[model samples]
Every structure is written in C-alpha cells, then in structure tokens.
Target: MVLRNIMIGIIIIVLVGGIICWTLFSKELREGKNLPLTGVDFKRLADGTYTGTYEGGRFKWRANEVQVTVSSGKVARIALLKSTEGRPSEFTNELYDKVIRSQSLQVDTISGATITSKAYLKAVEDALLKAQK
Candidate 1:
C-alpha cells in the first residue's frame, strides 16, 4: 500500500511539472510568432517622435512603453519608458543602441537576455510602425 502511494505521488508530480512546462512553452511559441519585424522602411516615416508599447510574456516580462525619435528619415534615439524583467535596465538600454546603430529591428538579441531583448525590440517595432507614413 505504501509503495502504491509513492507511485501515485510521483505520477502526480510528473503530471504537474509537465503541465507547467507546457504552459510556458506554448506561451513562448505564441510570442515567437510576433517576433519578426519586417518591411519597415525608415525613409517612408515622417520625422517626429512616436511611442509604442509591447506587453508580452506573463505581464512580468513586458516592455510597457517605448519612445522613438526620428529625424530626417533616420532613427535618432530610442527610450524605454517602462519595463519589467529580471535583467538590469542597462541590458534593455543596449537594445536601444542596437536599434539606433542598425536602424533596423533585425539586429541580434542580447546574449543571456532573450526575453528582455524581444520585449525591447517589440516596443521599438511598435514605435516604428506608428511612424510609417
């Protein structure tokens, strides 16, 4: 009887772990669909400031808002107004620099900070989308 109980407990634990893993995995997969930012033409955007927000992940790993500045058809600056994540704010700031330097969202994400990187990129993409035309 005791062995049976132990087996049942082990099974319950495995099932619970599997459910948790599946939940996180599916969420990441859904978010991945939105990762690609393409066909953004800087030249087509008007020179001005724009704002955007990407509330991704489980609300705890989100970039609430980002401000982008465009001048003379170039991305001049990017600022993160709000974000919630495990990494330091400086890591997020690196994303802004990458966007400004590359003038595109195709730049690589920061190593060891994939979620924050994606959130920051998404926020920038949102801002650029607003700048279109």
Candidate 2:
C-alpha cells in the first residue's frame, strides 16, 4: 500500500510539473511568434561590423547576442556570440546560412527550435538596425 501511494505521488508531481512547464513554454512561444521578424535593408547600411543582443524568449531558450558583418552594402557574415545555452547549436548555423543567403531576416525559423531561431533573428535585426545610415 505504501509503494502504491508513493507511485501515485510521483505521478501527480510529474503531471503538475508538466502542466507548469507547458504553460510557461506556451506563453513564451506565443510571444516569440508575435515578435517582428522583419528583413534588414542592407542597402541602407554602411559597411561595418555591428553587434546586437536580444533576450526576448524563455529563460533557457534565448539568444544573447549576434555579430553581423556588413560589407559593401551586403550581409557578409552573421555569428551568434552568446546564447542562454552558452554556445551555438546546429540551428544557429542553419539560421545564419539562411540569412546570409537571403540577406534578410525574413528567412524561416529552424524547425523544432523556433524560439531560439527567433531570438537569433531578433538579435540580427537589432544589429542591422544599428548599421542603418
């Protein structure tokens, strides 16, 4: 009987934890989706490197800063300098490739890593916005 009660308590704890996590993550995802993913107008930006940071997502899934290099009025490179995870992941590479290829933040977010992708994009946007001249 004691074992059964312990099992029941464990299940309840798991369920409650799941519910709380879901509520928090769902809210974060909604806010991330609402954030503007507008494309940067590289044409108007000067040729220089710019750094920007954004922390607009859930605590564990946010991009901290992005380093954007613009050259000759084009996006030359993009790098995620910092993130909540403390390092770049495969999603960051994919997102960077898309932005470099398209020269815009209008690229699609990485599947299964939407929040991180958006945070990276937001950081890129912020960096490029500063380069506008």
Best by lDDT: 2
Q: Candidate 2 versus the native: TM-score?
A: 0.53
> Which tens-of-lDDT digit does each residue in 19-78 have in candidate 1?
999999888867856676778876577889999887765644654688989997788888
All candidates' TM-scores? 0.57, 0.53
Most accurate candidate by TM-score = 1
53, model 2: CA deviation in Å?
0.6
For all candidates in order, the CA lDDT equals 0.77, 0.79
Global Cα lDDT for candidate 1: 0.77
lDDT score for residue 45 of model 1: 75
lDDT of each residue in 1-133, candidate 2, tens digit only: 9999999999999999999999998998888778786676655789889999887576747657889998877788888877775544788888888877876554445455456777888988997999893
